[model samples]
Target: MAEALADIGMIGLAVMGSNLAQNIERNGFTVAVWNRDPGRVDEFMATVGAGKKFVGAHTPEAFVNAIARPRKIMLLVKAGDATDWTIDQIKPYLEPGDIIIDGGNALYHDTIRREKALRAEGFNFIGCGVSGGEEGALWGPSLMPGGAPDAYENLRPIWEAIAAKVDDGPCVTYIGPDGAGHFVKMVHNGIEYGDMQLIAEAYDLLKRVGHLTAPELAAVFAAWNEGVLQSFLIEITSQIFRAIDPETNQPLVELILDKAGQKGTGKWTSEAALDMGVPVPTIQAAIDARVLSSMKDERVAASQVIVGPPTSPEMPDKGDFIMLVHNALYASKICSYAQGMAMLSTASRAYNWNLNLGEISRIWKGGCIIRAQFLDKIKQAYHRRADLPNLLLDPDFNQWMADAQTSWRSVVSIGALAGVPLPAMSASLAYFDSYRTARLPQNLTQAQRDFFGSHTYERIDKPEAGFVHTEWKELIQ
Candidate 1:
C-alpha cells in the first residue's frame, strides 16, 4: 500500500486543500490526492499548470489504494456532519491502524469524540490546525497536530519542512494530545475577533473625527502592514477597503451591512474560558459585539439602544487619541492571545499533553491563519519561562504595558465621546488592569460575602485572621 501512490497525501480539493496538497508536494512528499468530485481533479491538474508536481486519484477507492503501508489520510473538507459523511464514505476502504487527520476548524470536543469513535474500528485519528490561509497552504502552513505521539512522529517530516521557520526553527509541532490543536485554534480565532474589533474601533474614530476616507484608511492599514502592527488581518483589511462596486463605483464595504458573520470557534473560546473560570473579557466582548451587530433591525425598532464606547471622551488631543488607540490595540491583542495560551496550558496540565509553548509558537509561524512576527516574541517569552503567566508578565511586555496604560484610557474616553463602539478594545484594557492589579476594591464585596457566607477577609497589610469587626468603624460611624 505504501508504494502504490507514495505517502502523506490528502482528500478534498477546496482552495485551501488544493493549496495545502501543492505545498506538501513542494516540500518533497509524494501526495496521493482525491477530491469529492473526481472530475475536479483533472480540472485542477490543468489549473495548476504543473503536470509533474501533482498527481490525482481518479476515485476514492483508487485514492485509498494509492497510499502505502501504515496508511495516513489527511482530510481537508467542510467540517461537522459533512465531514462525518466523508469519513463514512472512506471507511470501507480503510484497514485497522490506518490514520486520519482532520485539518479543518472542527470543535475540539468533537475531535475527542471522533477519536474515540474511530478507535473502535482500530483507526488512529488526529486533529490538527492548518493556518496561514491560502498562500501559506500553497507554500508551507503552520501545522498544529495533536493526537497520538506515534501518529505525529510518522507525519513530522512532511510538516517540519513545510511550516514557517522561526530563527531556524520549524513552525509545526504536536500541539498536545487528543483535541488540543483544535482547542488552541479555537482560542486563536477568538483573539482574531478581538484584534479585528479594536481595528474597527480605530477606523470608526479616524472616520468620525480624524476625517479620513476609505482610501486614506486603506493607506493607514497598508502602512501598518510594515510596522509592528502588521498582521494577516491588517493586510487583508487594506485590500478589502480598496475593493469597489462595479455598478456604483463606490467602496464596496460602504454598501455592506455593519453586521459580521462567524463560524462557531470564537464563540466556543469565550464559552469555554467561562466554564474554566478564566477571565477573557476582551475576547468575550468581541464575540458579544458580533452577536449584537447581527441584531441590527431589532435594536432600531426598539429605539432604546444605548450608544457609544464605554470610556469618556476628554483630556486628550487628537494625536494623543490616535496613539492611545494604537497602543491600546497592541496591548489588548497580547492579552487575547495570552488568554488562549493560558487555556492551552490549563488543558495541557489536565490532559497530560506536555505541550511545549515555545514549540507551539514556532509551528504557528507560517502554516496557519494567525501566523505573524509576534509569534516570535511569544516563543521567546514562553522559552524564558515555560510557566510565565502571560506575555504581559514578561519584562519587555510589562514595560510595554506601563507605557500604554495612559493612552488606552485616553482612546476609550474619546470613543465614548465620539459614539463609537470599542467593546473589545476597551475590554482588553480592562482585562489587563484586572489581571495585573494585586488589589482590587472589594470592601463592598467582602461585606456581602461575610454577610451571606461568613467568608473571612484578609487585611490589606496582614493575612491571618483578618476579621471585619471594623466594618462600620472603617466608615467612622
Candidate 2:
C-alpha cells in the first residue's frame, strides 16, 4: 500500500548492474532496479532480488518514483547509443539536482559531451569508471567518479561504502570534472593490455626456448605471483594453464584459438595517446600484437613461405632463464605503467582536469585489472613527487630498472635471435632507452622533413630561437 523508497536506483539489470545493485544492498542501502525488458526485472525479483532489499520497477517512472529526493541513478547500459537512449527515456522523470551516473566503458570525449549536455538541462551527470568486471561489481570495485563537486559529495558515502578497500582507505576517488574518470579508466585498460601481452611474451619464450610443459609453466607463474608480480591476472593465468580442455584433453590455453579478441578500450587509449602527442609505444605495440594475431590465416600461410632464420639461439640454464624472464616482465611492466601515467599527466594538463596522479595509483591497488603488489611502490613514487613526469623517473623505479636492465636486455635479445615476436617487451625497452637518451636521431629526421616538405627545423646552436630552413640543393650541388 505504501510507496517503497530506495537510496539509489540502477538501470540496466545485466550482470554488472544486478551485481552492483546487490553490492549496494549488501552495504545496507535499499536499491531500486529497472531493466529495458520487464521480464528481466521480474526474473531478478524472483531470484537474486528475492531476499535482498531491492525495489524492482518495471518502468523508468516507477524507478524514479521509488528513489528518495535528489535521486542517485546509475546507468550500466552499453556505452554509445544505448547510453544516450537510456538518458532520453529517463530525463523527463528526473528533476534538477538528480544525479545520473554512467558506469560503462565510454570514450572520455563522449563522457564530456554528455556531461555538458545533461548539465545544460539542469541535471547533474557523473562519468564513473567501474573496474574489476563482474566479480568486482558483486563484491567491491574501484570507482573513479568525475562530475560536479556537489554531486560527488552526495554520492561519496554510497560509493565509499561499496568500493574495495586497500589498507584502511576505499578504492574510490573524485577524479576531477567531466570526463576525467573515463579518461583514467581508458589508460588503465591500456596498461592492462601491455601487462597481459608482456605476460604472454614471457609464456611464449619459456615454452619455445626453455621447452617447459604447461604444468611447469604454471608453477613458474604461480611462483611469480608470490613475488612482485603478484596480481589478479597472473593468478588467473596460472590457473588457466592448469585447466584441462574437456574436449581435447590438453591444457585449456593450448586448446583455445590463437587469435586474441579486444573490446576497443586498448585501441581507444592508443588513439588518444596519438592525438595528445604522448608516447605510449608499449600500449600501441600490444594493440598491434592483437591485430596481428587476429590474422590467423595470413600468419599460418606466411609461416610456410616467410622462412625465419634457421638457427634458434641457445637457451640459458633453465633456472637462470626463468629469472631472466621474470626480471624482463617486471621491468617492461614498469615501463608500460610509466607510459600510461605519462599520458594521463599530459591529458590532465591539456584538458585542465587537475587530476591527482598519486591518488589514482593508490585507488588502483585493488578492485582493478591492473592491481598488483608493485602498485604500492607506484603510489609512494607519486607521494614522494606529485609532479613526477614519469614513473621511470622516480628514484625507486629508476633503481629497479637499473638493476633489471641486464636481464631485461637478455630476454629481448633472446626473443630477437630466436625469431619470437616480443613486440610489447621490445617496445617497452625501446621506450626506456629512447626516454633516457639526452640526444636522439630526431635532428636527422627533422632535416629530412625540412628537405622534402619544407617543414623547417629548430637548431640546437640556437635553442631559444625560431625554426630555420636550409636549401639542400645548393649544398648537394
Candidate 3:
C-alpha cells in the first residue's frame, strides 16, 4: 500500500489545468495529476511535469487515494455535465471532510445547486473562478473561491501562495458562500466587454475622425497607458496596434475580421441583471455590440445600400480631438464600472451573500483580465462606505464625470455624425445621464400601462394615495 503524500490532486490536464497544476507545485506543494485520458497524464509527466513535484495517477481510485486526509481535489474540467460527471467519479472514494473544487466558468445558479447536492452527501464543494488567461495561470491568477469557510481555510495557504500579488497582498479571497465567486466573475466579464468596446470605439474615432495611423494610434495608447487610463486592456491594445502581419507586412488588426466572439459570460451578466431588475445598460450594450458584429454579412450588404452619409468626415484638431476621445473613454469606463458595482451590491443583498465589495475590488487589482489602476479608487470608495449604492456616487468619480461630460457628449455626437456606431460608449453616457436625472418621461409610460392593462400607477401630488388606476380615455373625452 502506497502512502498519501500529495498535497492536492488536479483533474483535467488541459491548458488551464496543466498550468495551474504547475503553479501549485511551484509553490512547494506536491501535486497529483490526472486526466480523462491516460495519455495526457503520461504526456504531462514526460514533458512539463518532469523534474517537478508531481505524482501522475492513472485511475480515479489512485488519484483520490494518493491525496492526504481531508483530500483536496480541484477540477479544471469543462463546466456543465462534465463537471458533475467528474465529481461523481471520485465521490465514492472521498471522506466526509474532503473538498472538491470546480475551477471553471460556471453559472452561479449551477454552483449553488451543486453545493446543496454535495452538502447532502457530507462533502464540501467549491465553485472557484480563476481569471487571467493562460499566462496568469502559469504565473499568478486571481482566484475567487466560494464555499464553506472551513473549506476555504483548508485551501487558503495554497491559494494565497499561488495568487497574483499586489502591494504585498494576494489577489485571492473568500468571496462569500455558494455562488458568489462565479457571480462576481460573471460581472467581471461583463465589465471587460464594456472596456473592450469602449477602447474599440476610441480607436475608430481616432482613425476615422482624427486621421491617426496604426503606429500613431499605438503611440497614443502607449501614452494613455502611462496616465489614469492605465489598464491591462489599454496596454494590450497598444501592443495589438503595434503588431504587424508577417505574411502581408501590414497592420495585423486591419487585416483581421471584424467579427467578435463571446463565450456567454457577458450575456449571463446581462441576463442576471435583467432578472434582478438592475439596470446594466452598458453591459447589455456591450453584448449587443458583439451580436451586431456577428452580423458582418448584413453590415456589408447594408453598406452597399446605405447612401446617406459620406465616409470622409472633416477631420478635427489632432491634439484636442485626442484629448476629447480620452476623456470620453474614461468617463464611459466609470459608468460601466458603476453599473457592475451596483449589480454586485444588489446581488449581495438579494442572495444573502454578505459580499465585501472593497475586498472584491482589492482582489481585482492584480491578475484578472479587468485589472485596472482605477480599481484602487473603487476599493477605497467601498472601504469608506461599504453600502455605497454605486461607484458613480464616489466623490472622486463624481467630479471626474462632471469635468468630462462635455467631452463625452461631443465624442458621441461626432460618432453619430461620422456614421460610426459607438454602442458601449454611447450607452454608458446614457446610463450616466439617466442615473443623475431627477425626473424622467416614465410617468407617461406609467399612464399608458395603466390605460392599457390597468396595471395602476402611483400619485406624486397626493401623499396618502398609492397604486391608483385612472380612466384616461373617459377623462380625455
Candidate 4:
C-alpha cells in the first residue's frame, strides 16, 4: 500500500472542521483529517468524509505525514489552552516552511505570541478568521488570513477557491502580519453584538410602544430587510419572530427565556478598546445589555419595585413610527460600524499592522455574519476616501445621518418616554453626537479629575504639548 497524500491537513473533526475539510475536498483538493478523539475521526471518515477525497489519520504525526511537502495544517480546535496544546502536539512533526493556520476565535494577543514562537522555529503560523457558521464552512465563508507574505502566497489558492465570491471576487484577503485577521474577526463579533442589540431594541419599541403582534413585527423586519437594513442578522430576526412554538402555539421568541449568553469575543473587544483608549460605546452598550439581560430575576424584581411614569407614552401614528424606527435603526447601525472601524483603525496604527480598511469592507460584503447591502456603501466610502477617519464622516453616510437625524431622535425620545430599554440605540446616538461636537463636557470631567486626583488637564487655548494641574483647596491643605 502507498502512503496517501493530501494537499491540506485539518485537525479537530468538529462540525466546522469537517465541513471546511469537505469544502476543501469539493474544491478539487485532497484533505487529510485528524481529531483528538479517534472515534470522531472514524465517524467523519464513515460519514461526511465517506465519498470525499480524504485521508483520515488517528494521530498528529500521521496527519502531518499524509500531507504534501511544506504541509498546510489548520487547527479548528477551541481557542486558548487547547490551541496551545495542539500546536505543541503537532510541532515535532512539522518541518521548516510548513504552515499552521488557526481557525478558532482566539484572542489576538494569543495569535501574536503563537506566530512569533512558531516563526522563530522556521514554521509559519497563520491566524485565519473564518466567518459564516456551519453552512458557510461547507459552502463558502469570508476568509481573513494574517501571516508572512510567503505563507499567504502558498495558501492563497486554496483560500480563494473556498471563499465566498462577491462581484466575482473572493471574500478572502491577506489581513496583515501576526494577529490582524483574528483582531478584525473579534471586532466583527463586537459589531455583530451591537447590531443584534439595536435590532432587539427596535423590536421592543415596536412591540411595547406600537403594540404590534409578533407576526406584524416580523413583517416590519422583513420589509426593512429589503432596504438599507438588509443584513444576515435582520433577515434571521424576522424569521425568529415568525417561528411558532410547537408546544405552546405562540411565537417562539416570546416563549424563550430572556437571558442572553456570550462566548467572550464581545467582552474582549470592549476590553481591547478600553486598553487602547478607543471609545466603542455602541459595542460596550451591547455587551452591557447582555449583562443586564442575564439578570432576569433582578430585572423582574426591579420592575415591580421601581415604578416609572404611571402610564406608558401613547403610541404614535403607525406609519410615522415605522419610518422613525427604520431611520433610527439605520442611523444607529452606521454609528456602530463607525465605532468598530475606528477601533480597527486605532489598532492598526498601534500594532503597525497596515490593515486595509477598504479591503476589509470588501471581503465583509458576503459570506459573513454581518454581510449587508449597507456594506457595499461602506466599501464605496472607503474606496472613495482610503483614509476615511470614520464612517460617520463619509459624505454619503454624513448626508444619510443628516436626513435621518430627526426621525432617529424621535424614536429614541419615544422609547425613553415609553420606558422601553434602548441601550445600544441610545449609546450609538450619543457616540455620534460626541464625535460631531467640537467642544465636549469632557473639560469639566478633566477638571474634576485634576481636582480629586491631581491628574493633569490640557488647556483648550494651549497647544496639545502641555498638561497642567490646578489647585482647588489650598486653604484646606
**Backbone clash tally for model 2?**
0
Weakest 10 consecutive residues, lDDT, candidate 2? 307-316
**Angstrom error at residue 6, model 4:** 0.1
Score each candidate by Cα lDDT.
0.78, 0.94, 0.93, 0.93
TM-scores of the models, in the given order? 0.87, 0.98, 0.98, 0.97
- Candidate 3 lDDT by residue in tens digits, 1-477: 765489999999999999999999999999998898999999999999999899999999989998997899999998899999999899989999899999999999999999999998999999999999998998999999999999999999999999999983999999989999899988999999999999999999999778899999999999999999999999999999999999999999999899999998999999999999999888888899899999999999998998756665555689999999999999999999999999999999999999999999999989999988999999999988889999888898999999999999999988987888999899999899899999999999999999999999999998588789888888995
Error of 2 at 422 (Å): 0.2
> What are the per-residue Cα lDDT tens digits for candidate 1 across 283-387?
888888888889989968755766545664454565555566678777777877777788777777876778788777767665566666777788889989998
How big is the positional error of residue 16 in model 1, measured in Å on the Cα after superposition?
1.9
Give residue 257's lDDT in candidate 2 (0 to 100): 81
After superposition, candidate 3 runs with Cα above 4 Å error: 1-4, 308-315
Q: Going through the candidates in order, what is the number of backbone clashes in each? A: 18, 0, 0, 0
**What ranges in model 1 sit over 4 Å off?**
1-4, 45-50, 53-55, 244-246, 302-318, 441-477
RMSD of each: 3.9, 1.0, 1.2, 1.7
Q: Give a tens-digit lDDT track for model 4, residues 1-477.
A: 995689999998888998899999999999999999999999999988887799999988988999998899999999999999999999999899999999999999999999999999999999999999998888999999998988999999999999989994999999999999999999999999999899999989888888899999999999999999999889999999989998899999998798999999999999999999999999999999999999999999998899876777666799789989999999999999999999989999999999899899989988899999999898889899988899998999999999999999999998888878899999999998999999999889998999999999998788766999878787455
lDDT tens readout by residue for model 2, 34-107: 99999999999999999889999998898899999899999999999999999998899999999999999999
Q: Candidate 2 lDDT (Cα, whole model)?
A: 0.94
* Candidate 4 displacement at residue 377 in angstroms: 0.8
